[model samples]
Target: MAEPSNSGGSIVSGVAGRYASALFELAQETGAIDAVAADLSTFEALLAESEDLRRLVGSPVFSAEEQMSAITAILAAAKIGGVAANFIKLVASKRRLFLLPAMIRGYRALVAQAKGIVSARVSVAEAPSEALLAEIRTAIAQAAGAEIDLEVKVDPALIGGLVVRVGSRMIDASLRTKLNSIRLAMKEVR
Candidate 1:
């Protein structure tokens, strides 16, 4: 599969782009994009939870065969599909395991673009009701003219209100931010 040319695009073209574009094209061709995405999510979680795995992937001393064997075993144990398992082997063979995370993120963005969907990340002091979440999703979709996939997170430090982030735009309505703004205003007034 030919790598999709993301030339002059906002994809932060680099080594990560090369790998991501290649993976995206392959996934699209094989009709495995969703599976690959799910596999990458698991890989991402593993990276987050295992410092040893992170170091292992980043280690330059590990031979390609060693890396491939280890990664293949890990993915197989995790029940990842053959496509994702082989993709990891390919990355290992290229000694590019360290680039996996960036590639995963770039591939996700490409998938989102292809699906015409936007992701909204909402951080609040507490969990919002289902109705409130539905309302926010509706508002975001209306504004974006695209379907919104909401990812809700709880941050107690917010104190109250919510912080909504859609792509590069951030709506900071959290009480923490509000209090900071007021403090800055008082300092300026004084």
Candidate 2:
């Protein structure tokens, strides 16, 4: 990934950040950051896998009370901790349920920064060896001057090589891009 601009402070500092900061502060006060993070992870996974859940949260037709009840039930079903369960209720009450995913992402970014870690997304045609993963993580950590948490994804369309993304910066070194470049060069040569 391309380097993040130095001017960008604290990876999470927007509307999402405001909500996440509030949640993070509450989690810290209750000594439940870990629990809340886990709950958010569960919610994130749910959102990723379920369009119905995502639409429900984003729906404006649901009254605040209705949303709160629904969310509370969902959390209970998922066995989320008390702190996170209560926080979900708070978001529902405020009609901010739609912001949950963004808030979760923001909170994660905050937590990572607080722990001196940077999150990186690595995409390749296939999974790399453990040693290669370690080397990539080390290189990213060195470049970012922080501990690295790498998230790997496989994209067969990449053909070969890797694409690394860290926040807004992206390093595109995929064979697909190389082939496109070569194709353009050949056309120019003709």
Candidate 3:
């Protein structure tokens, strides 16, 4: 995943938050919240996967009009329309594409909040199996007393085990942490 432009999942604050709030209200009013959210997710993934596209959005090299036109063409090709298409065009025209990812995240937070589901980030040493994911989801659901909307990732540096962060609470069971503990113990040995 691309490095986040701001603090953590959809905590939406400052300029990004305001833009997100406005977009959320518009999407909500038009009943296009789901469509917009999906489009934004696709756009975010596109940004992550395409370095050129990311640069176009975030670079000040392109004029507002150039960015706007390119984004419109891209959105059309992607079949993204409705409030999402219009809102994003407006953002690009205003030169706010740099914050698009954050706004998208904020919008997601709004949608998830409306649905009463909590989003959690979990990273494991490698891709988790279906059964393992299901078990983790079940555990998180039970602990949060709400539906689990999990975002799972793999970090090979962890070596083994998993790390979970549900809001401010973090459970680290990664092999890296265990190794660090062992290293500290050896250093203290006389």
**lDDT by candidate, in order shown:** 0.85, 0.83, 0.86
TM-score (all chains, Cα) for each model: 0.84, 0.81, 0.86
Predicted structure 2, TM vs. truth = 0.81
- Per-residue lDDT for 1-190 in model 1, tens only? 3333345455646888778887888889889999999998998888899888898799898888988888888888788866777877888889999888888888888888778778899999999999998998898899888988789999999999999999889999999999999999999998
Q: Residue 141 in model 3: shift from native, Å? A: 1.2
CA deviation > 4 Å runs, candidate 2: 1-10, 127-135, 142-145, 167-169, 187-190
lDDT of 3 by residue, 95-120 (tens): 99898888888888877877787889
Among residues 3 or more apart in sequence or in different chains, the pairs in candidate 1 whose N, CA or C atoms overlap within 3 Å are none
Off by over 4 Å in 3: 1-11, 182-189
How many clashes does each candidate structure show, in the order listed?
Answer: 0, 1, 0
Query: What is the descending TM-score order?
Result: 3, 1, 2
Q: List the residue pairs that clash in candidate 3.
A: none
For model 1, the stretches where C-alpha displacement exceeds 4 angstroms are: 1-12, 129-131, 185-190
Better of 2 and 3 by TM-score: 3
Please give the range of 10 consecutive residues that has the lowest summed lDDT in model 3. Answer: 1-10
